[model samples]
Target: MKSLSLIVLLSMVFSCNTSAQKKDDQLQNKTAFKVTKTDAEWKAQLTDDQYQVLRKAATERPFSSPLNNNHSKGTYVCAACKTPLYKSEHKFDSGTGWPSFDRVIEGNVAFSTDTTIGYMRNEEHCATCGGHLGHVFDDGPRATTGKRHCINGDALEFVPAKS
Candidate 1:
C-alpha cells in the first residue's frame, strides 16, 4: 500500500509540471520574441485606444486617423518600440480608415502571412518589437509601386524632421 501511494503522488507531481510547461510554451509561441515588456507594462504605457488598436489588433475608422491629414516630411515610428517604419514621402491618401503608406522605411518592418480573416492578407509589423501595425494590399494609387500599406495610425508616432 505504501509503494502504491508513493507512485500515485509522483504521477500527480509529474502531471502538474507538464501542465505548467505546456501553458508556458503556448504563451511563448503566441507572442514573438521581440516583445520584451510584460503585458501590464504595455497597458500602463499605452492609452486604452492605443492598446486596443496596437496590441489587440483593432482597426480605426476611415479618415478618422490624425495622420491622414499630416503632410509634413518626417518619419513614422512605432508607438510601442520606436522603430521607424514609414517615411513621410511614401504616405498618400488611400481614403481608407487608416493611414496609407506606399513604402516602408528600409528594413524597419517585416511581413507575415495572416489568414485569420478567412482571406490571405500580408500582415505588417515592427521588425524590432513585433507590434502589429496593419495589412498591405496590392491595390493602391499610381504614385507608388502599386502597394498600399493600410496601417493603424494609433500604432505609430510621427516625428517631423527639421527643415
Candidate 2:
C-alpha cells in the first residue's frame, strides 16, 4: 500500500538523520582542545557557577555580574581556559543585562548551533577548550560586525591593563 511505503520511507529518513547527528557529536567530542580535562578536573578548576555555565552550558542570571557594568581597559578571557576572547573596546552595554561585545579576538572563539533554548542560536565557545561562553546574535552595532556576542559574565574573567 502507498501508506505503508510512505511510512517506511519516512522512518528510514529519520533514522539516517539521527545517525548523522550522533556522528557529528562524536567528531566534536574528539576535537583537539588545548585545555582538555575530565569533568571532575573542570569542576575543581572552576567555581560552582563557572562549572555550571562553562561545562554544562548554563546561563547566569542577567544583571547579576559586576562585569556587565565594568568599563575599564582590559581583556576578557575565558574563566575556564584563560583564553583571551573579547577586548574591552569591543564590549558594549546592550541593556540586555549581559556583557555584549561587537566582536571577539579572532581564532579564539568558535561557534556552533545551539538548540538547548528550544531555538537554534549561534553559541560561542572557547576555541581552546570548547567551554561555553554564550550566544552570538545578529543584532549589534552596524558599524562593526553587526553581531552581538552576548556573553555570560560568569564565563569570563577580566584582566585590567596596567596604568
Candidate 3:
C-alpha cells in the first residue's frame, strides 16, 4: 500500500539522521583552543601517562596521583600550556581519587560534549592547549560554587605559593 511505503521511507530517513548524530557525538577535540603542538612535540614534552590522559582523553586510575592528597597552598596549572586553572583554596577531598575543586578559573577551561562511554557528559578541556582535564559535576561544596571540577592530577602541575 502507498501508506506502508510512506511509513518505510520516513523510518529510513529518521534512522539515517540518528546514525549521523551518533557519529558526530564523539568526544574528539579537533579544534585547537590555544596551544598547538605537533604530536611528536607533545610526546617529547609530556610523560607517558600525562600524554595519555591529556591528549587521548583518558582518565588516570583512582588514587594514582599524589596531587590528590596535596594540601599545600599553591596554584594548579594546565600540564600542556601552563595556563592557571585552579587554586589551592578551591581544592577539596571528594574521595573520587582525583584532584577536585569547587570551581575552575573563569574562562580558563573549555567544555565539550563527550559521548565516548555511550553516555553524554560535559568534558572539560584546557582553554589554552585544548587538553582533556576531566568532567565537571554539580555535586560540590554548598557554601561555594556547588560545581565540582574533577581534574586529573596528571593533567595538572602544582606550583607552591611563595611565603
Return the top candidate by TM-score. Answer: 2
TM-score of each: 0.77, 0.88, 0.84
Give the per-residue lDDT of model 1 (tens digit) for 1-163.
9999999999998777565455334333436446667778879999887787767777777777789889999999999988889999899988776889988987888776666789988878777766778999999877658999999989999999988
RMSD of each: 8.9, 2.5, 3.6
Model 2: per-residue Cα lDDT at residue 151? 97
Better of 1 and 3 by TM-score: 3
List model 3 lDDT by residue over 64-112, tens digit each.
9999999999999999889999999999999899999998889898777
Candidate 2's C-alpha runs over 4 A off are 17-31
Count of clashes, each model: 1, 0, 0
Off by over 4 Å in 3: 1-30
Q: Candidate 3: worst 10 consecutive residues by lDDT?
A: 22-31
Q: What is the lDDT of residue 65 in candidate 1?
A: 76
Better of 1 and 2 by lDDT: 2
Which of 2 and 3 is the better model by lDDT? 2
Alpha carbon deviation, residue 156, candidate 2 (Å) = 0.5
